[model samples]
Target: MTAGASYHGQPVIKAPVWTWQIPWYFFTGGVAGASAGLGYLCELRGDDALARRAWAAAMAGICVSPALLIADLGRPQRFLNMLRMFKVTSPMSVGTWILQGSAASTAIAAAHAWFGLFPRLARVAAPAAALLGLPLSTYTAALVTNTAVPVWHEARRTLPFVFGAGAGLSAGAAALIGADPATAAPARRLALGGAAMELATTTLMHRGLGEHGRPYSQGRCKHFDQAASGFLAVGSALLAARGSRSRTAAAAGGVLLLAGAVSTRWSVFAAGRQSAADPHAVIDPQRAGIARGERIGGARTEPVARDAAAPAGPAS
Candidate 1:
């Protein structure tokens, strides 16, 4: 089967309604979640300056993430509807509550750093933000994979790690850019580990996808994925050499890691969209299921009259 082939005389797949806003939301939200946790780690290490910088990054991400989500929803009012009720089975609903908690706690932490207003509350708020951050960093993977898209669904087991690693890379890059060398050492280590994890999980995801992974490795999607991989590799190398090199090199490495993180989110979004638009990508799985004696919903076990020359009276 080819990308353009039809199934049962009709297109087996339809294009996804999601747009660029979704990918941006995923990237920013992941960054915010990881940055919040990184800030708490810095605080625990007694690095107030670096902690403040990480909190600032989290604040920035918190501000942008909602706007991206609203834009993708295509109506400012629709976001309110999402908060009307919570469903445990719905990743989006759970994510909405998580984002709310993360944003409020992060905002309070940022306030204490930026002003003397919440000095006493900072200890509690900061830790709470970090706790919420754990879920925020990984829930987007659940949200994406919960959909009907074949590639996203098939890669479900590995997507969370991929997204979490990307989030760590983004947060570490933000810290490296904003903090001093001594304070930035943790960030460098995080970038190194995140780069390695991202590379490994991405490889595993694609391999697990089998033929369904073709969309990710072909055309424009391939370019984005390759670029992300290259950037991550170079950034990791530069970060490793930071002790022997100038801060300028370290900063450049951070920037590259940020680029790679954003590109990776974009690549995943595009590949999922492409997979949804290809008929073969949707049909082949069901065909395999049928071959294995699995009863596919809405599928006929017997040939239709139109497909057969005559209908059999009865089966022996």
Candidate 2:
């Protein structure tokens, strides 16, 4: 709200710039995402302690950040206004409710983990919340996808997958660093899952975005994202093979994964800004569409719809 206090160093634009809450939303997503894997692993091993800590950290995150989100809202009071306009189509409302449910379910699971009054009940809550947490993590990514930000809005097809993978890795790192595993098997497992997802997602996103991936490839965001992608791959491989039995390898893997996750988030934020800061990403495509509009893959206007049309074709 300060005069020309927008975008820091980036160029001014016609549309409203992203808010701080956008990035905070990214963090909560990671917490929620990682919690799910941790919970699943816990349930698999019957290690209630790990599961409880994971859920507690995750739930605590979900509970606290929604309040932060409200505060970050341009109209703070308008935050609760979401409940009034619950649209299945709106990521904001969907995410809001997901956070609420995720928070409540996580709390219930944490209680079960702590109290030990009913094993059967807790078992149900853990998997249920874990399932929800996966989507809860990247609901914000979907929110960004629906936006008009040149790169982000268009990259909607792959953004959720990218962020979701980051969330999974973050959760793995948190468990590894925050908890001392007897054999580091859990940490290694998480690293492998996170690494594989991150690499695959990045590859697909780049291919899908094509020229749109320019900012991501060349800008500050690119540096961090590239590093994350590399670290994730290397660290995951090392952790998977070497750390299964080595305590120090697990510790190192935790550090690597944390660094990778940090870079991943920072890169995404920077890429969104860069993509919007310049007109080349947005205007050129549309302008050129005027003279010689070749709808490669799909039209410039209806990428999502065209993508949807693919499955429809087969179904019909």
Candidate 3:
């Protein structure tokens, strides 16, 4: 099978039904997760002011994430149904639980930071929230790769790191806004590291996919992907020079980093949709697998059909 060939010249696999809401949900959840970790680190370092700011960022993301998820679910009521079941095998179930726990923990940490209430309990809650943030940051990548979509599934190993880097960039950028230069230094360094990691992983993922990555480099997705890489590169460079330059330069870099993070997610989603819409993207892998003698049952076993066409005798 090739991209030019299709069933009745139509796509074999349907494009994913997900919309912007899902990507936004991913972005917000990721930011929330990273912010929680950043806040915890600040607290451990005894920078209460910086920690409060970081927690505020986490709170902002937490407030918006559920709305995005519910909007993606199409009905607010459907969101409740997600909690009605708990299945270990289902990523969605696991994600729902993670989100619920993260929300509660983050809320407590944020409250403690702002009001100074629950001083005894806050100590426990802050670190717990940060611990929960670890999985919260990377689980969305698992959710994406677990789907049947070829582009996402093929990059399963790399996507988690990519998303983690993106989350770090977002959280760091958020932390830098309105923060003192001295306090923001750590965030700037973190964002720089994130940009570097994102670039490296993205390059490896593209090379790993080879021809299968065409959709990401072509058409609309191509523009977004290129833009994301460019912005991240420039932003990280500017941030690296923050010591020599004014705070304005670093702030601009932060904004650009955030843009790059958003663009990266959007591009991935768009590329996956393109891959799913192309019939050959789904069939070619199976054909290649069959050629390599991989087991494909039922209608997918083309070699079985070929062998069945051979002439046979009935005597034996």
Ranking by TM-score: 3, 1, 2
Question: Candidate 1 — what's its lDDT?
Answer: 0.85
Q: Lowest summed-lDDT stretch of 10 residues in model 2? A: 1-10
lDDT of 3 by residue, 52-127 (tens): 9889999999889888888877577768999889887787789889889889889989999989877787788888
- Per-candidate TM equals 0.91, 0.79, 0.91
Which digits, one per residue and each the tens of the lDDT, describe model 2 over residues 1-316?
Answer: 1132234454544444556666756866677656865876686887766676676667666676777688777788777687886787888888888777777677777677767655676677777778888888777788877767777777788888888877877776666764555644565576678768877887788788876777788778789788887778667766777665666777687778767776777777777887777756665655456658463433344334346436643222
Q: Which stretches of candidate 1 lie over 4 Å from their true place?
A: 1-10, 243-245, 295-297, 302-316
Return the lDDT, model 1, position 72: 82
| lDDT value, residue 271 of candidate 1 | 91
Clashing pairs in 2: 34-171
Clashes in model 3: which pairs? none
Best by lDDT: 1
Residue-level error in angstroms, candidate 2, position 61: 3.1
TM-score of 3: 0.91
lDDT per residue, candidate 1, 1-316, as tens digits?
A: 5444465555466667888889888889988999999989988998878888888999999999988888888677767999899998899999999999999999999898767568788879999998999899899999988888898988889999999999998898888874567657888888788889899999999999898888887877899999999999898888787722467877888899988998899899999888887777888777777778885445556654453666653323
lDDT-superior candidate, 1 or 2: 1
> How do the candidates rank by lDDT, highest first?
1, 3, 2
